[model samples]
Target chain A: MDTSVRSKGTLKLMIVDDSNIIRRRIERSQQIARLEVVGAASNGRAAVEMFRRTQPDVVTMDLTMPEMDGIECVEELIAINSEVLILVVSALADKATAVEAIEKGANGFLCKPFTDRQLNDALEELLSEA
Target chain B: MFKEAEIRTFIEGTTNYFETSAQQSATVGSPYLVTDGNPGAYEYTGVIGVTGARKGVVYFTAPRGMLTVLLMRMQETDTSDENIKDLVGEVANTISGNARRDFGKNFVISVPVVIAHDLEKVTTPHSRSFVIPINWRTHSAKLVVCLE
Candidate 1:
């Protein structure tokens, strides 16, 4: 638990998933007071572009996406902003996929079809690491 | 042909989707083979293409009314056609994605292709497909697994 990374105001959050409903769900399910969503994208390519523009502190990334999957996007985002914290939010339940995302620099993993409480808890844990 | 355990993985996945996402446990009746020409899809179908170790399509077809209620349960106010499509697609994606836990990484699934039309009339590539009946609340839907 490192509190030295962020000063603790409003954390800029980005949602990246191929499903529009998922993006909206994540947007509406925010219970944490510090998390303020900055932007969202449907694919990893757009996510990368948005990340560059908005420079969000945290990103909830989906693994299986259209252009440039999350694995590649994770690598790219880490290269640009090593300090950025990313949580792999995906339906890929295999352990291998989770390991791969973490290996590429994602901070945490939350599986799809998650409950609102589960989502908030994951985000809380993600930020606690910072 | 998939093993019984493999098919069970999908059944568990489908039921788990309802339990976790919808917050209600859906009843999945025993799966039966669709011998008739039609595989029997409802008003809205979310189709996902499978690749890697397996090749075929896995879809979840439900009615507009069912999806609308589902959206409402998820705290979504707008139940537009696009929203309905998104819900159906997400269901298909979640179910297929969860299967990877048992089927491993080779059971790769594609993003959903939502169909608002009647899939009951469409001809499927596979001669035989397994249809898993799902009942939630007063609504009924089908989870069709057509693999080769």
Candidate 2:
């Protein structure tokens, strides 16, 4: 992924995580990466709702949520807009679930406890692809 | 029975979660086997059940002060009891999830169940737990792993 391209035009992004701390961390990291966090949700249900309302360019989703899991949300979002870019940012890093999510239509995956650089790179890679 | 490598993975996960997520460096003390008795007491605890190849439980316990500091650093102004409980569960979930990389798909971890208070009686009778002492910024916590 090319990290040098500093496209200042704010890329609307949505962060989905059950933990308030994780969401805050992602929001803070996105600010550093020059990505605009237009929406934040604690679960997949909220994620889909917010995605429709915000129409974000990219989404960072977390699996194992209470209401709806990230894989289902990925499918829902893809159904809503086939071109939507969804990145699974989850603590559950198992390859089985990762492959399942990809099959469900997630654009990429980033495991939890990620650094700012990793988050930025994933977002940038997703954005570049889009 | 739990393997040494599995214990090491859980320890590494705990340390990494604190350092990376909360920006707090966690130093793990010597791990002792807990055949009986509780793994100390704390204001909050996060317990998760593991299925598949490993069938048992994993938990993280910490005081309110430590969790409050963590929440503050995480940019949360509301350090209420509910949020603190939620933070503890999230921490445990992240740690267990990190360990999944080493344990693979067979080590299926469930969502965390947060408990606020009376953690002294909590015990896994079926398996001996390895209680790992973790200290972060003058506050202390424990990561308990019991598997069969």
Candidate 3:
């Protein structure tokens, strides 16, 4: 695990979702003073490319997307940087899908239609675990 | 034909969306079936294709004014045409995705396909659509469920 996140000052974050509103909601709901959004991607293919370039310490991922889904993107992201914390932010409200995402490599799961407080709490939990 | 309980699943999902995301409750009127050409649609519509366990389209249609207000409720300042479309699509996606809890993982859903004042392309032949009326504040929207 990359423990240098605290030493690097602010933690770099990435937002990956197909919906522009969702991406923007996550971006605008950033209440963590130490967390800074580094990049945002619409699809998994674009997310993979952005992950390579930005190397975000954390990522908020959505499962159902156009080109590449969140599951594949999570695997690729972990392969690139195993220490990167990922929280699956999806509307798919099924235990099987959530378990599948966790099995693949997501650190946590947050259902859609979440409040701002819920989002901040989830992100805080993900970072605390790391 | 879907059972009353099956349809209720979607109704709960719709009401839940407003309460959770928008931080306000939306009243759901009685659901009715529309087997004609196309059901009523507002200025903007977001369509999602369903496959796997079931096959059809699920859409959320709302007026431009309602969507603009919804965007504001979500704290989204950008109410451009593109953002409005995105907001409507997210609503449709969230409703359909929430149904996966009852439909299981086999109920596959596609990414949202936003439509602007066009309903002909979304009509499903030989299928009756269940229109669930959603009343939020002074605005009215519809969640059309067309599934096999």
Range of the 10 consecutive residues with the lowest summed lDDT in candidate 2 chain B: B119-128
lDDT of 1 at B36: 66
Kindly report which residue pairs in candidate 2 clash with one another. Answer: none
Candidate 3 residues lying further than 4 Å off, grouped into runs, are A1-8
**Clashes per prediction?**
0, 0, 0
Kindly report the docking quality category of candidate 2. Answer: medium
Query: Per-residue CA lDDT of candidate 1, range B60-140, in tens?
Result: 999999999999889889899988998899899999998899889988898888888766544456877888999999999
Best-to-worst ranking by DockQ: 3, 1, 2
DockQ leader: 3
lDDT of 3 at B146: 86
The best candidate in terms of lDDT? 3
What DockQ does each listed candidate score? 0.80, 0.54, 0.87
Chain B alone: TM-score in each candidate? 0.94, 0.93, 0.94
List where candidate 1 sits over 4 angstroms from the true fold: A1-4, B120-123
Decreasing TM-score order of the candidates? 3, 1, 2
TM-score of chain B of 3: 0.94
